[model samples]
Target: MTWSIVARDPETGAIGIAVASRFFAVGARVPFIAPGTGAVATQALINPLYGPRGLALLRGGAGAAEVVHALVADDSGRDHRQVQVMDARGRFAAHTGTDCVDWCGAIADDLCGLAGNMLAGPQVLEETARAFRENAALPFPRRLLVAMAAGEAAGGDKRGKQSAGLVIHGTEDWPDLDIRVDDHPEPIAELARLERVSRERWVHFKRYLATGADPVGITDRARIDSEIAAAVAAAQAQDAGEPAAGKAPAA
Candidate 1:
């Protein structure tokens, strides 16, 4: 019914989940994240409690493997549940119930977690993990989309795609990026388009939103506009393979 990738950005310490499924609004139910804790994606015959409950455990200092173990051990539906977790320290764990549908399972390493049920084949997850490792240079959010697209190309959701979502958390309580497609003919492509649109302003503007360290964040509209303009200009330059104004190209 779904496939997802949970990952931590090595450079920025951001954590994220990318999910696509035949299920309606899969994003609303799976993929739970808390910036200071970790991330969880619970599916298969999912027990939604795992999302919040698992995050609580991570916040309380449990590791990924420990959280997975605790969540499964206490559930009567354990035999049908599929879950994967990544802790703040980057430890990872996955569980696929004994009774999950064929082609359903999970894989995890410190760098990422890939899990799915009702998938076209194991390659759905394999290709996702491969792209994730190979595309480390992509911006964190775009890297997740690229990795998930590789999974879809490998034959995602045996039933076909209906919805897709990407949720990312950096060093803040709220998401750095969150976008979902509840229903779409080509969900992943639609998701990509939405992400592109968000960059025009939301991506640049979010930097001014209130954060833990700054309760009243960047109230000056003129300064905010200036930063957004500069950010837009820099992004445009980077996209054109030119250095940002007054900035040197990467060596």
Candidate 2:
């Protein structure tokens, strides 16, 4: 019923998950990530517990393989669950339950794991992983979107698309970006639009928020507002292929 990619950005140590499913609100249950720990996607029959428990194990120094092994070890329904994990160290592991619907399986490689159940075919996961690997130059979040989009193009969830989501975490425990199209005819496109919307303001605004290193973030409202305005205008200018004011190239 779903397919997903769990990955860690080797350059920034950011970890995240991107997922889509025929099911409603797949975002609410499928993808889970801890900032400095790892990421998990649990689908197929969908064991919600695997998300938090897997992250906890990752945080406790369990490798991706150990985490998956532990999670499935005691579950009587393991044969019906599909889960994948990528640890902070770029280790990867996955499980595609034997009882999952046909066209189900998983692939794990350093820094990435891809898994799906009830998919159109093996190409879905294959293209997803391939895209992620080939687009290493893209920003982590955008790379995820591109990869998922490739999977969709290769034939996504066999039943059709409904919900899609992307989640990313930076140095902070909180997510740098978490957007979902809980139910949409074109959930991936909707998710992409939301990503653009986020770039319009939220992305720059987040810089002023409190962080672990600086509990009390920027307090000067006027300065913060000015910075945000400048950031937005600069982004707009870049989108238009023009240099921002005071940033023009020298003749």
Candidate 3:
């Protein structure tokens, strides 16, 4: 019903997952990440437990392959499950249940995994991996978006499109770069646009935090607004066409 990719940016030590599907709110159900541990994508009869369990295994010092092994080995329904995982150290692993609907498969490599069930064809996973690899020069969010676009182009979930989401954790704050198109006509594209905007917002926050430069008194609400506006504009200007490229910053 869905496909997703979970990865860790080695340069910045940032962990994130991007997912899209014909299923509504696929992001809410599929992608999971622990700030300093790893990322997980659980689909195909969607065992919500995989999200927490995978994180726990990684937190306990298990590598991606080991964590996935533990999850599949413990579940009697292994043949009906699909999961992808990337540990903090950048090890990657994935599985597709044999019982999954037709055209199901997954690919894992270099701290990244792409998995899908009931896809239009096996090409979905292949295209996704290709997009990710080809976009190595892009920022994390752009790379994620490109992979998602590739999947969609290669005949996405046989069920069609509905919702999309992106999550990056282990940042300095909660809700760190989390964006979702809960139910939209063009969710993947919308998610990409939201991610771009989120990048601008992060820049504003960084400027505020690093410079202690506020437009007004600490107590003035209006001054706070202006300072934020200015910072956002600056960030946008810097990002637009300047070739934004860097791993997500460490938590």
Candidate 4:
């Protein structure tokens, strides 16, 4: 009872997954991503091993198709599972077991894998991939959200919706954005609200965290707070179509 998208942003090298399901806490189990490595979404009967094992294989230089093949080859329960992998090279591969519920299948392109089980119909996956492709100019996280939204609009989990999640990994080992709405009547909308809230502060604050390139990230608390405030103000101004403070409006 789930549908998901796994994609890699070629320009930014960011990888992410967006998923929604009638099942509770789908976020905790379905989507897995490692920065600079790859992403996986496992559903249907839901073999949790596909997530980490797929990432390890990708890290070991396995292609997306190779990883999917290896995973299904070793699993005795492959026929009940649905999984998708997107490798670091922007290649995608997916598998939907023959025994998975009706309306279950997958679609893949160069940069994304779309899969779902017990969906409204094939249009759900089709619209998801189309939206992601059409919204190439959007920021990675927003692109994921919009894509999932389109799928939901087309008719989400045939059983109905209970939870949704969005996860993105950038250059850091940690996720750039990880938001979930577990057990909500309108889970996707709640997830979208959380995304907006995250942008207001958490996203900007994360830039100050130490990473591979910067071990001692901005230790000055005052400076960090000032920068966050400035970012928020600038965003608000931009949203209103007004010039940011200290910047002249174009004539």
Candidate 5:
């Protein structure tokens, strides 16, 4: 029903997932990630339960393998299930239920996971892992999209592609990225284009909100620095000379 990869870059603390399927809007159902938390990919007969449960386990300090074991143990339908998990610590794990459709399997690598069902062969997952591991020049989302494209080229979802998705949830100061190509003729390619445009739009919005201070019109750094210095001076002025370290100031 679905195939995906969940991964985190140890150097950047950036978590990402890439997946594709014959199903419509694969993005809407398979991948889940929280900036500082972790990532999960739930597919193969598609159990939505694993999304929140996996996240909860990771947030509670469970490692990737531990969470996968717990989830599989708890599910009576383990053989029909496929899932991949990577924690914030970059630990990785994956599962391919025995009952998954033909040509289905997964590959869990150092910092990434790849899975697929109804693929041309095991090469789908292999290509995904190879593309991700070998590409050092691309951003996280683009890397993900490239890996997915590689998977598709390697005979993805044997039934052919119908939908694709990319999701990234980060800090409040950073906008979250979520894109979907549902029922598109060439989903992965379209998804990549959408990602590029969306990223540009985000940059545009950020630029438009600039405070007219820096060369790029960002926040007024000089003014802010001056204000903070003034506040510090005022606090120092309220203090008596040579106050004891660690002692409260006299009222």
Candidate 6:
């Protein structure tokens, strides 16, 4: 009933997950992250405990494989659940319970992990992982979405799509970007639309939010507006394939 991708961005060290399923609010139950620690996804008769418990183990310095083992070994429903883990070091691990529905399996390596159950076929996972590996130049969130969209096109969730989600952690316990399309008729497309809409203000606005280094971030209205305006213009220019105002294009 669900499929997901958990990964670490080699360039920025950010961790993220993109998932879709023929179920309501798949976002609420499947994805979890511990920022600088790692990311986890639990599905197919999901053990919600896997999300928090898995991250706790990773935060405790367990390897990806060990985290997956500890999660499954202690659960009586191990034969009916599916889980995936990606550690800060790029190690990834996955598990598909023997009792999961047809077409259940997983793929993992240093780059990413893909897992699903009650899927159309193995191609769903294959195409998803392929897109993630190939779309290296996309913005991190977009790259994750592109990969999930590709999986959808390959006949995602044999039952059909209803919900999808994208979550990412930059360097904090909280997420940098978290988007969910709960109960949408076309969740993946809706997620894509939301992702694009986020750049309009949310992305830039979040930059002003307090961070660990400066808990009392900028508060001056004049400064916030001017800086946000400048960031927006620079982003828009970059989106248009033009160099940002007063800045040189990348070499």
For residues 54-99, write the lDDT of model 2, one tens digit per residue: 9899989999889999999989999999998888788888898899
lDDT of 3 by residue, 1-251 (tens): 88888777666777888888888788889888888777889998888999999998898999988988999998999999999888877878887888999888887777577888989998888888777787776767777878778888888888888998888865543445788898988888888778777765563454334222444325555776788888777767756764322122111
Worst 10 residues of 4 by lDDT: 242-251
- For model 1, residues 1-251, the per-residue Cα lDDT tens digits are 99999998888888899999999999888999989679999999989999999999999999999999999999999999999999988878999999988799888765799999999999999888887787777788778888888888889999998999999999998899999999999888888878878888999999999999998888899999998999998887776752111111121
TM-score of each: 0.94, 0.92, 0.83, 0.93, 0.78, 0.93
**Superposed model 6: Cα runs more than 4 Å off:** 241-251
How would you encode candidate 5's per-residue C-alpha lDDT over 30-107 as one tens digit per residue? 987856878888888778999999999999999988989988999999999888888877777888899999898777
- Worst-scoring 10-residue span by lDDT in model 5: 242-251
lDDT of 6 by residue, 1-251 (tens): 99999988878888889899999999888999998888899999989999999989998999999999999999999999999998878788888999999899998765789999999999999888887887787778888888888888889999998999999999866688999999989898888888878888888888778999889777887888888889889877777862221111121
Which candidate has the highest TM-score of all?
1
Q: Which candidate model has the greater TM-score, 1 or 2?
A: 1
List the candidate numbers ranked by lDDT, top first: 1, 6, 2, 4, 3, 5
* Clash count, predicted structure 2: 0
lDDT agreement with native, every candidate? 0.87, 0.86, 0.78, 0.86, 0.74, 0.87
Q: Write the per-residue lDDT of candidate 4 for residues 66-127, one digit (tens) a residue.
A: 99999999999999999988887888888899999989999987768899999999999988
Off by over 4 Å in 3: 172-175, 200-203, 206-230, 242-251
How well does candidate 1 score on lDDT at residue 189? Answer: 82
**Residue 55, model 6: Cα distance from true site in angstroms:** 0.8
In candidate 1 the C-alpha lDDT for residue 222 amounts to 98
Model 4: lDDT to the true structure? 0.86
Question: What ranking of all candidate models by TM-score puts the best one first?
Answer: 1, 6, 4, 2, 3, 5
lDDT of 5 at 243: 26
